[model samples]
Target: MKIVLIITDYGSFNNFLSDLAIRLKEDGHEVSVITSETRVINIQDKFDYLAAGIKFFYVDFPRGFNPFAHYRSSKKIQKILDSIVPNIVHIHFTTGIFTTLFAGRVKYRTLGTFHGLGFPVLSGLKKQVFGAVEKFCFGRLDKIYVLNEVDYKAVKALGYKNVEKYETLGLGCDLSVFNPDNFSETWKASLREELDIGVNDFVFAYTGRFVNFKGYDKVIRSFLKLYSKNSKVKLLLIGGNDPIHPTGLTENETILMNNCEGIIHIGFTKDVASYLSITDVFVFPSVKEGMPVCVIEALAMGVPVITADSRGCNEIVQNDYNGYVVDVTDDNWSGVYEKMEQLIINKDYINQFKSNIQQDRNDYDRNRYVICEKSRYEQYSSIEK
Candidate 1:
């Protein structure tokens, strides 16, 4: 079977598509990708975009629409789809391009994978309000995929049937790069030395983009409360800043970054797993999420986790079993601070988070779950085969 993935964000380094492409090809299916270019988007630009034997088609999807922009951009995407003639179309986060919707015009099967935007109100409502338009856009999809249970229900509530909700491949972490054995204890200790952090200092880590909804500001406030007492806790914020546009950083984010207390902005580092290995605890306080790959990486590395109470997160940590999940809100931060304090004060708890991660590591491989994606795409695209 041939598989083509559609994504609104694509550059040299993004792994979401690259990872999936490798999985599909290793399983013997031919794969291709249609990506929306991000000139200023560096999140996934460092890695080889064409690593796997997959062809990539570029289209400038009107990420945000203007009448003229949409007209030209959408046409460019449509032309490429016409040429590729994919047997199966897989759409990821349909923010910029409308090509998948247009592809629905063909007899081929198409599927949409919901990575989810973290808003309590189910922010997907914006595109879906236009039922006829969405129906036409979706174009006889064989299946629509959701990573978390909330994502599944959100799409279903939109009256979208023929949906498949897959369990996460706890393998969200790149085990190849993130393997616990890859870095020895001495290497991790070197990281502490390089950062000028004392070996005994309680180092806490918060990774992922520093956007408001991601809950970094809340984490800083909680840290202030912790620091007021002069606790030894220190933090490392990975991806704490994005280029202030060729234009400028948004005032809200800029203010938050400038004022973040006791936080070390590492800028962007390719050596995530190494830093993650040396960290004492992994903290996640996102207001919304769809199975954060960051937390999964932390778990696979055997670090204890603290995440905001959200459905996608619930699916990962069973609250007090694998980790702690408090209702994600600004007011409940004190309780979150308390939980981290317990782990900080107790060495045994940190040992537990590490000792048991290997037990659950095999459960989240993208191959097992992602295969269902190809299977569904195949079943729907063909008739009486």
Candidate 2:
């Protein structure tokens, strides 16, 4: 079977779907990827895919809203689809799925994996607009795979006739890479020393694009407040700003992230596990997500997470068990601070969460996710379109 995987950026492919692509190829399927070029695209990921005998096709799939850009992207996708004539078109990310669906008629079976629904987190007019767009696009897909219960429920509620199946199979983490046992105490201490992180410091890490919706500003503000009260806490930001997305951080927030003491902004690095190894607690306050691989990775590394009570996050975090799930609705982040303070002051509380994570970490392993995805592809490919 010849399969074409479509996504918004090469970075997303590298971080999330690269393993699945390689697995599909290893399963004897001819696989190809279509993505937009961005600074986040790791050249190593590109070469790795090429070496694995997978093909690459670049498209201009912008993240922001622009009808003209979407139209142009749809045309480019249509051309690619015509050229490839793939058996299955598995599109990821909302932007990529929308653009490819907007391409009008195509012969291949379309499968989309909604990372998360933006409309659920959005308000009034924007929510209505996105909901309508989602309904239209979803109605055209042959199959759908949602990463979380929230997304699955949202699409199921739409009751699209064209959608043959939609399941909540989360985007899994590479447990072998993120496992805490992989890193020794010596390595952790050495890395901490290099980063100027004190051995006794309670590290709070957030790894994602520094964007408005991600709520990095809220994380920074809360960290600042905590830093003032307790100087032993440090915040490690592991991602860079998203230039293509309209939700990039504000100037003041950017400045704070870069200039704030006790806050280390490491920009972007593929070595997230190394940072996670030294982390005491992982903090993600994003307003929305599909099933965040970062949160799963943190859990896989036996690091407890403090995240928002949003769709994807609330589902992953069992409140007070794995980590605290703060209610950040209507810009209420007091709970975020309170939870951070609780974890900081109480070592026992942190240890308890780590204990729970150790028992349940296997639930987020990448091998299971890959096998499930491969089975789906094989099943779909064997069916006559």
The candidate scoring highest on TM-score is 2
Model 1 over residues 248-342: C-alpha lDDT tens digits? 23566456545755556675555777778877788887756667777887777777788888767777876666677777564556757887778
lDDT of 1: 0.65
For candidate 2, what is the TM-score?
A: 0.94
* Worst-scoring 10-residue span by lDDT in model 2: 160-169
Model 2 clash count equals 1
Question: Per-residue alpha-carbon lDDT of model 2 for 1-385, expressed as tens digits?
Answer: 8999999888888888888898888878899899987646342453377679999899988666788888888988889888998999999977888988775856788888878877756789989988887776777778877777666666667675443323323778887788888899999999999999987898999998876677676788788889888888899988876665544446776676567789987767877899999999998977778778889889988889999888888888989999988888536768888888988888898899999988987788888888887778878888887
> Positional deviation of 231 in candidate 2, in angstroms?
1.6
Colliding residue pairs in candidate 2: 115-290
Q: lDDT value for candidate 2?
A: 0.81
